[model samples]
Target: MPATRRPIRQLPDELISQIAAGEVVERPASVVRELVDNALDAGATQVTVRLQSGGVRLISVEDDGQGILREELPIAFRRHATSKIGNLHDLESVATMGFRGEALAAINSIADCAILSRANGFAEAFLLDGRTGELRPVARSVGTTVEVKELFYSTPARRKFLKTDATELAHCIEAVRRHALARPDVSFAIWHEGKLVEQWRRCTDLDPVIALDQRLGDVLGQEFLTQSMRVQTIASDNNLRPRIWGRVGIPDAARTRADQQFAYVNGRFVRDKVLAHAARSAYEDVLHGHRQPVYALYLAMDPARVDVNVHPTKIEVRFRDSREVHQGVRHAVEDALAKPRSAGLEVAAQLDSAPLNNGFSVEVRQPQSVPMYSAQPGIGLVSKPEYRFGMQPDMPGHKVSDVGAIWQRETAPVADPIPQEEWPLGRAVAQLQGIYILAENTQGLVVVDMHAAHERIVYERLKNQLNSITGAGAHPRTIVSQPLLIPVTFAATPDEVATAEVHSETLVTLGLVISPFSPRTLAVRAVPNSLVQGDAVSLARSVLAELGQHDASTVIERAQNELLSTMACHGAVRANRRLTLEEMNGLLRQMEETERSDQCNHGRPTWRQISIKELDALFLRGR
Candidate 1:
C-alpha cells in the first residue's frame, strides 16, 4: 500500500530557534566564546567568567560594558535582531566581534538564560527570563550580566554528546585566552567550580609595544618572550592594506602540536588557511618536519576586504585576495626569523655590563663590520695557501709559524689591548675539542660552534649568488636546466593543469620546464640544474600543487635551497680540523655581516655568550 505524503509545514518559532542553536551552541566552550564576544563588542574594560560542572550546569559572564536598555531586553533574545548593524553596508565592514545577533538567541534556546542590565542613566536594573519571556526588576551595576544554566537542557540528545567535565573546562579556558590575547587593555578573569583559575590584568602602559609585551608575558608565560622573536611588518599594495605583527617562537621553542599557533584578522580570532600556510612555509627551512611553528600573529586590514559571514561560528574568514595575504604573512615572518641573533647578544651585554676593577666602564655597542680575512676563494671553508688575514701585514714583531702563521700574523700584540667596541665577539683565545672556538670580549667569554657558523655563512653566500643570477631584470645568457632522460609523466588535476599553462613563464624562470601532454597528464621535461639530485617527478608534482594552492610556486627555489644547504654543510669547516686563531676570528667577523648567522640550516644556535657576572654567580662571589 502506498502511504499518503504528509503536508509540508513551517517550523514553529521555538523549534526554529532550537535548530539554529544547534549550529552556534555545540558545547560549553562555544557558549563561552559567544558570551565573551558580546562582552568585548560592548566595549567592556573588565570581564569575569564563572563556570560550574564544566559549564554544563552553570555559566555566567559579567562585563562592565555599556548595558542594554530595558525596552530592548526582549529583542536581544530574538534571532536576527542586533544593534551591531543596521544595513547591508554595515555587513561589508563589520569591525565588532559579534554582529550576527544569533549568540543570545541560540544560547537561550538550549539553556535557561537570563540577562540583567542597567543602562547608564537608568535608576534600576531589569532582568529578563529567556525561557518564559518574563521581566522583573533586579539590582545590578551599570553594566550587563548574562547567566546560563543547565546547558543543552532542552536538547537531551545534544547534552549526551558533551565530553567529561575536565575537558570542557579546559576548552572554556582556551576560549577566554584567545580573547585576552586580542585585547590587552581589557582585564579578564575566569573561575571554575567556585575557584579563580586564571586572570589577566588590564595593561595600563601608554606605549603599545610595552603593553603588548606585558600582556604576552602574562598570557603565554614570561619564558616565551625570552625565547621568541618580535615580528612587525607593514605592507600595502594597490587597494590592499595589510599589516602583520606579532611574536614568533624560535625554532628551538617549537612544539609537536599546533595548539600554540594563533592568527587573528581585524581583531577577531580566526583559523584561516592562508595565514596557516604562510607561517608554515616561512618555517619550512628552520623547523623539523614533525614540529609546528608557534606564533601569535595579528593581521589588520580594511574590513571590507575580508568576509566573516562565511561560517556560523565566524572563526573562518574569506579574503578578497588570498594571494596578497599569503605573501604578506610569509615574507613578514621570514624576515623576522632571518635576522641575526646579535640583537639578543646586545641585550645580554646591557644586562651583564659592570664596572671593571680599574674603573673602566664596559660599554656594549651595536654590531659593526670589522676587517678580518682578505677576499679569497673558499674563505668560509678550509683556509688555502692563497688566503691571508687582512691584518697580517699590520702587526710587527710577530713570528709566523707554518701551522699557525695566519693566527700569529692577525693576533693583536700581547702589549696592546683591543678597544671594547672594536669587536663584539672579541679575539680568539683558544680552541676547545677542535669543535668550539673560545674568545674573550669586554663583557665576558664567547663560545661559537665553528661548523654551524661556517655553514650559515656559506649558505648565505650561495643564496645571494643565486639571487643575483636569477633575480628580476637580470638577463641570463642561458637558463641552467637539466633534461630528464625519462621525461616523467604524471596525472594532474584540472586546476594543476591550468596553473602550469598560465605560469609556464614563471616556471621557466625558476629553471623548470613542464608541459601539459594530455587533458589530465603533465610531463616534466627538465628541472633546475641545481636540483638534479632531487626526484624530478616529485618536484614537478610539488610545484604544481603549490601553484594551484597559492597561485605562486616556491618548490623550485625551495628545492634548490635545500641542495645548497647540503653543499654548504659538506663544504663548511668540519670539527677536529684544528683552525688557526686567524681563521677563527675571520669566521666571527663574517658572522656579524651575514644575515641569520645566529642559527644554522638546521636551526641550532651558532654562538652564545657567558657574562662575567654569570661566572661570578656560579662561584658565589661576594657572598
Candidate 2:
C-alpha cells in the first residue's frame, strides 16, 4: 500500500511565531531570563521584577535603561527585529546579552504582552499591545517596562504543565540570582505577590575587587564570602587572553547538590560543560565523592572566540577552542585553592568583630606543662641517648618508631618557641584516644585525625619522589615490571581493546604490558612491581577504562596514585598508638609544608581549626 503524500504548505505567521515560542519560553523562569537579558542589554542600571502566581498570571519587569523609540515600539515585538547586532561582524563579536531578537516575539506569542517606553529624547512614553498591535501615548519615565499577563492563557495545554506557585517562584528567584551575581554594579529587586522577596543594592566602592566581594556577600550571604577563597588569575601565556576570577568555597563547605555553582562568560551567565568539568577537575583531590563543589567563576575573553547563540535560552555557550578555556578555568581554580589557608581565621575575625551588648572577653589559657609520658625507650618516645640513626644528642624526644628511622635521618628538629602566626596548625599539646592530635595555635584549637594527616603527607612525598626520579621532559623512569609466571587472559569489548592499543605507550609508562591475544580477548604480560600483589588482569582493565574516559596524560598518574594511596594508608601510624609531644609536633610541621595536606587521599578533611570566637559562642560568652 502506498502512503498518502502530504501537501507542503507555508504555516501562518502567527503559528510560526508560536512554534518559536515553544523553544524560548519553557516556564515562568524562561520568561524571566529572556526579559532580564533584554533589560541588561538595554544598559539597565536598576531592574525590578514583580511576579504574581508564579508569573502565570502576571510578570512585570521595569528597567531604567535606554528605551525603544516610539516608532520602534511596534517593530520591537515583530520576529527577527533586534537592535543588538546589525551585521556579521557584530554577530561574531556579540557583547550584548539579547542578540537573537526572538525573545520578544516568542514571549508575546505565548502570553499577552505590553511594552511602555519613553526614549531618552522623548517627552512622553508610548504603550503598545503586542497581540492587538495597538499603540497609544502614555506617561512613563525615560526607561522601559514590559508587562506579560495571563501566560499560556490562550493555550490551556501548556498551562497544565505549570507547577505550584511556590516551586515556580523559586525557579524565578534563582534565575534572577544568576543575573545579579554576574553584574555587581547593577541593582536588582524582586517582588512576588506584592511582597518583597530579594533585593541586592549596588556596591558602593568603585574598585572592582571590593565591589565584587561586597556584591558576592550581598547575593550569596556573608557566610559564603567568609567560607570561600578568592580566585583571580590572568593567563600567563601570551597566546591566551582569558582572565578567570571569582570565588570557590572551601572543601568543607561542599554541598550535596550542584545548585550553588554559578559560572559566567563575558558577564553572561551560562552552564557550559567545559566550564563545569574544569571546575570539577580542579576539586578532584579535595572534594569527597558524591559531594558537589560550590563556586561563582567568571571568565573574560574576546567575544569572537565564544558563540552564545548555540542555545535558544542563551544559557549554554560553545567555546571555539574548548581545550584552552578548560585549561584556563582549571588552572585558575587550582591555583586559588592550592594556597595554604589560615584555617578559618577570616571567618573568626568577622564573628569576633560583630557587635555584641556584653563587653566580656574570652581567654584561652596555654598548657602550664607538657604532659610527660613514662620514659619507655623505643615504645612511644625516643630519647636523645636512644636515637641510633645519626640522631643529635641534644635533640628533644623524637617519635622515631611511628614513621620508622627514615624520618629521623631526613628531617631536622624544629626550633622551639615557633611563632603562632608562622605555623597555623600550631604545636601539638596532647593526643586524644591515640587517634586525634590536639594542638594550640593563634586560633583556639586545632583537632587533627592523626592517621588521615600522616596518610596524606606520605602520599605527597611518594609522588614527589616519583616525579624527581622520572625527571622533567624525559620518559618516566620505567617502573620495574615483573613478568607474570602464568599469563592471564580476559574478554574485552572492542572499544576496550582499541583503547589499549591506542594508549599502548601510556600503558608501558605505567609498567603495564597488554596485547590482543584474539579478536575478543586480551593477555597481560607484566605488571608494575609495586602492584604485583594486585590482580594484574583487573588493574589492566581498570587502566584501560581510565584511559578511555580521561586524557591520557593524567590517566597513568591517577592509576599510580590509587596504588600509592593504598600503600600510604597501611604505612601510616594506626589508631590507639600513643605518641610523644615531639613526634606529634614533627607530624604537624610536615603537614604545614605538604601540598593538599588539608585532605586525605580519599578526600576527607584531615584537620580543623576551632577559633576562639566559636568556643566563646558555644559557652554563651558575652551573649
Best by TM-score: 2
| Worst ten in a row by lDDT for model 1 | 1-10
**Candidate 2 lDDT tens digits, 440-547:** 877667788988988787667656545656546565655555576666788999988998888887777656788899989998887654344345566677778767
Q: What is the C-alpha lDDT of each candidate?
A: 0.74, 0.74
List candidate 1 stretches off by more than 4 Å: 1-22, 235-239, 343-385, 388-427, 440-445, 469-558, 609-623
Pairs in clash, predicted candidate 2:
none
Clashes of each: 0, 0
**Tens-place lDDT digits, model 1, residues 341-408:** 55334232243222223532233332455334333333422244333211122222233232232222
| TM values, all candidates | 0.73, 0.76
Each prediction's RMSD to truth = 12.9, 11.0
